[model samples]
Target chain A: MGETFKANVIDHFNFWVAVVLMMIGLYAMITKNNLIKKLIGMSIFQTAIILFYVSAGVKDGATIPILEHHAAETEQVEAGEHVEGHPVANHEAHAINPDDYSNPLPHVLMLTAIVVGVATLGVALAVTQVIYKNYGTLEEDEILAKIKAAENDG
Target chain B: MIWQFDIIILIFLVITAVISLRVKDLLAASMVFGTYSFLICLLWAGMGAVDVAFTEATVGAGISAVILIATVYNTRRDSSD
Candidate 1:
């Protein structure tokens, strides 16, 4: 029981931490009305997602698949195939298996996600600025009151 | 091992829900919500859902938060209290 503690504890600890962070971020977004604080919440929420992705993508001791020309080549020296005149050694060509490489799918997906995130953030910020200009105050209640008054007057 | 991870995630989830309910400041509440999204994303990562994680990070943390905040900006600064 004692020996299995590390495996039982460490892995669970990381998972729990991520879950907690997510919960906190989500709750804040739903109930908070302050604009800046909302953005802060947004940032934290986004960061938590990033952390999850990284945690899931990491493979133990996996190397990124960068293709090296000679790396795939295998040297097969025949018993008496050596010739003094030839500068290059003759090795039979061997087929390469694609399974030995790290996965590139996640990286590609992440790149797109990152781009989309930034674009969304920019648009949201612009909208917020506009709202601030029109409402004078950024509070939800005040905006509601103003709208309510306008409705009542008309 | 798998069960442990699930349990951990579940516990955080509960805390987040409770905090969101108890907090007074709407701004603070939103911030906490965003944090919740982030935590879920990390959980996806741990589960070997790299693609899902990427999507969640952007949609959950990035876009969703922005939407809420932008909406917030349209309103009053002070809470109802």
Candidate 2:
């Protein structure tokens, strides 16, 4: 049982770390009363998720997704010889093996996610500013209290 | 799998996170949050996700922290709660 636990720990260490970070972020978001701090926690949570996804796409000793061309085929071209039908000269003619590269799909998807996160954060901060201007405090409880008091006055 | 380095970085990340949450000063929290984002960027880069790391560095560490600091500047820096 100990050996199995050790193996799992070794194999999935990144995931475990990511989860711990996520929990920390969740704790901050839930417990913090300050609006900006909550935003910080939200960013932390988003990044932890991005790390988890990026780590998931990793393979042992895998290179980047960029396709590589064989040097031998390129060498002949440098020798002042145009080799007809040479796959190296025509990048589209060569089919790359998917196994050679780290999975790029996650990176692509997370790119959009990161942009969206920034946009959301901007909007949230803008709203927080508005709240501060209206209520004169950024604390959730204080803002709620102000709203309730105003409602009673009306 | 280079687990040792990852463990060390993650430990620092958690420490920064906890510290950010515990600190009463909002500006200090924002700085600590930037450190957290940077650590995650390193973690992503180490895991072979250069593009994601780049995005994290630019968005999480750069823009988000800056915007938060600006907002903090515009409001109260201390939390009453």
Query: What are the Cα lDDT values of the candidates?
Result: 0.59, 0.82
For candidate 2, lDDT tens digit of each residue in B1-81? 366888888889889988888889998888888888888888777776788888889888999889989999998799753
Clashing pairs in 2: none
B-chain TM-score of model 2: 0.95
After superposing candidate 2, which stretches have Cα over 4 Å from the reference? A69-97
lDDT of 1 at A151: 93
Top-lDDT structure, candidate number: 2
List model 1 lDDT by residue over A15-87, tens digit each.
4565666666676677666554555455556555554554555454444445566654433333223444444
| TM-score result, candidate 1 | 0.53
- Lowest summed lDDT across 10 adjacent residues in model 1 chain A is found at A72-81
